[model samples]
Target: MKAAILLIGTELLNGAMIDTNSIYIAEQLNKYGIEIEYKIMVRDVIEEMEKAFAFAKKNVDLIITTGGLGPTDDDITKAAIAKFLKKKLVVDEKEKKELVKKYKDRKIEKKSNFKEIEKPEGAISFKNDVGMAPAVYINGIVAFPGFPNELKNMFPKFLKFYAKENNLKSKIYIKDIITCGIGESILEKRVKDIFTEDNIFYEFLVKDYGTLIRLQTKIENKKKVEKIVEKLYNKIADFIIGEDEERVETNIFKYLMAQKKPLTISTAESCTGGMIASKLVDVSGISASFKEGIVCYSNEAKIKRLKVKKETLLAHGAVSEEVAKEMVEGLKTDVAIATTGIAGPGGGTIEKPVGLVYIAVRVGESVEIIRKEFKGERNKIRQRTTLFALYSLLKMLSKRYDI
Candidate 1:
């Protein structure tokens, strides 16, 4: 089935609010193999809303709208749809009673506030448990409240109702191979030959964590999908971090936690701030393996907190591999990761330009230091350093444990 989304709000057009509802709606519809052909954003003008309705009705099988459902005068979604369908607007008495009971203790003027319960004549109404507005389904269009929380709560019920009415079933099957320390172009070039099958499809998304290689097929047989996944795995086994929904930090956390003797880890960060530590901490129950993280941004802090030699900083500078090695080694954990880089629009010399990073991973008696040059703005450079450090540590541990 094909559908279109109409996001309505003057706030959205004027940059006062962001329309996250469309993204959520699209993801949910994609699971049912519903193709989204258009995403239209309109201001809170009735004329514009009517035009959008006409376009959606003429082009798509289904239409979904979010926003302009409120008690205020500008809330004209129901009015516009009713006018477009040549139907009369009437207040739902059952919904009005519920609203009156809900706000009984508060002093609210029913003459104006009860407009929240209005719907087009002969349209099916849906309750909003999270907010004051009532949603409606009339003539192939489903109207929802603009608030994200309310829309999220009401969407599932609408989906269930629509699925029963249309006899829709989940159609999209998906698998994701999350990998790190690899560029999208290089990974795609290596695996381009594996996508020859007509029944299977592939997509590559490069996120801050890494590049995610998505393998999908409409074919429902699990065994057939597994065969394709296994073949692709063998081709890029060394670069793969984990399977679907597994990030590099999560992979590292799980690997460390499953060890017979859990290895404790710590972090000493400079240019990346505490992003590496933050990612590890996001994984629940990681404290068993993650000890602590120290942000030694200043030269004095490095010398005092992580016990780096003052002479080393004076000779080789703080952004050198020597300091990164000392930073990791001084942590006194079974494993440690350290990063020092120049992520900036300024403060770079001919010797060390911006995006120059040194990462160190120390495990037991051995320490590995790497020098890397990345390109981007400040935050992007820092993000690259953080992901590279985590992936490097994971690769090292995987080899050590033969995972």
Candidate 2:
């Protein structure tokens, strides 16, 4: 079913607060095979909210609105929804009693203010476990508070109720493969048949260092869908590095731990700086695997720290595949990853220009080096280099363990 999300708040328009509720809601809806067609951010003004509700009612099968539900006057979601439905707001007795009991120690005047929380006519109320405002459902429009905690509690309950009422079945199975050293066009050609299949949907997302292809299959019969997914997975298994929610680093960690292998890794980063080391250390329990990192940006540091040959740096200009290989090999660890390149708006030469990165990974006694040229801003180049280093290491590990 098509869904439209309406995020109501002046704070969002002013950029004072981010609307994370939309992302969470969209992810939850996707689990049930519901697609959100449009997302609108509107101020809390009555006219704007009313106009948004009218627009959603005509175009979308279900309209989910978050924000502006509270005791304050600025909270106008309920009022606008009531006006749009032409229904009078009446206090929900159960909600009023619960609010009073929750704050029984407070004065009666404080509790009296909460009596204003009322639902529009014929609307079912969804209880909010994390906040005071209750979510109201009228027709296809489901309204919840703008507060993330309250929306988190209410939106899931609303989805559960809606799924039961409509007999909705969630049958989405997603498989993702991480591939490096390939462009999106080339990957698309390789997996064109999978996308053109009648029951499956394909999405390709390009990252800094590599590309991720996600294949989704939606079918009512679970057994048939599982078989299709298995066949597709086998067909593309050679190109696949990771699947579903498994990241390269995560998969590498799991693989290492499973093998009961103890490892120490260090880095000699030039263009990528400490980005590769930072990503590896971000995962918990990395101390068991990571040893140290060296950011050898200059020739002196490379020679002093990573012990790169001075002649190699002068000849290769510090950004060649040969130097990248030396940086990885000099680390003297179980595995070492290194990057050398020019990621910038400036620093371009006829031979060694910007966005030219060389990544090398050393596993056991074997060292593999790859030379790539990326096109983007400085930050994008750095990010891509870091991810590529991780992917190369993961690929080497996979070959060693036969995984």
Candidate 3:
């Protein structure tokens, strides 16, 4: 089955709000062997909505819409669909009761919710479990509420309903290989052999944590798919960190978890401003390994907090590997990671340009410091710096523990 997504919102067109609904819908549809042929974003105008609808009917068999399903006057999704399908809009009695019960449960006595319960003629309206507004399945079009949480909650139910209604043959399968300690461009070149094979497809997404190689196939044989993944893994064995949904900190945390006793770790961040610590803390039960994180941005903080020598900062400047080395010395933990950088559009000279960063990793009795200069905006520079810090920590943990 082919699908098209129509995301309607003036806020999205104006850049005030981002439309994440299309991505969710496309991924969900793909799982059920539904190919998304087109994704369109239209402002809250009936003419534009009808145009999007007409285009979808010509190219796809199913249509999914998200957004503009609100109580406000600008919510014209139902009105536009009604006009396009030549169907009358009427109040869904069952949906009206759900809306009333929902309001009464919250002590709201207003009957204004009846307007929000309107549905297309002969449409199957699904009640929203998490928010106001309802999702509707009618005439080859499925409409979901614009709010992300509401749409997410209703998506699974819609999928079950779609499965019962239509018989599907193909099933989408996906495998992701997440790798770090290598550049995306270099990784792309490394995987040229995989892409060179006929009748196979791949996608490479470069992220701050790592580059993710997503492999998708509709072939019925599971062993054939496994063989493709194994070939890719063999090609990039040294660079691969983990599989789908795995992260740099996750891989490191798994290694630590395998040890007999938990090892405590600390961070001393400069331009990254505790981003490394934030990522590690995102993992649950990390308190067993992650001890503390501190952002010592100023020279005084580095000196007073992390015990960086004043003489070192004066000699090598704050953005040097020497200061990063001194910053990790004060941390009293099994391991310490420190970063100092110039992530900036300003504060740069000929000797020290923007994006110049130094990451220091200390494990047991050994310490390694790396100096790198990235090319990007301030935020990108900081993000890449944190990635290198985690990558370096992973490399050190592997060597020290032989995991």
Which candidate leads the pack in lDDT?
Answer: 1
Q: RMSD to native for every prediction?
A: 5.6, 6.7, 4.6
Give the per-residue lDDT of model 3 (tens digit) for 1-403: 7889898899988999988778777777777788888889899999999999999999999999998788889988988888889998899766777788888888877676465667788888876987878888788988887998899899888888888888764377777788877787888888867665444568888866688887776656445667877887788777787786688898888777777888788999999998999999989889899989999999999999988899999999999988988888878888889999899999988999999999999987689999999999999999989988888888888877855
lDDT of 1 by residue, 1-403 (tens): 9999999989988999988899779877876898999999998898999999998899999999999888898999988889989999888788888888667645555454677788889989888886788789988999999998899889988988888899998787777788877788999998888777777778998777789887776748456778778987899888888886678888887668777888899999999999999999989888898899999999999999999999999999999989999899889988899999899989788999999999999878789999999999999999999999998999888888643
TM-scores for all candidates?
0.75, 0.69, 0.77
lDDT value for model 2: 0.80
Q: lDDT by residue for model 2 over 1-403, one digit each (tens)?
A: 8999999999999999987888778867987888998999999899988898888888889999988887788888888888989999888788888777656644445546763368788899898776677898988998888888788888879999999998897757655567665568976776576544576666788754357776666645445545545765676554555665566787777656666566677788999889988887877788888889899999898888887899998887788887888888889888899899999889978787789999999987899999988879999888888877787788788878743
Please state the error at residue 295 of candidate 1 in Å: 2.5
Worst 10 residues of 3 by lDDT: 192-201
lDDT assessment of candidate 1: 0.88
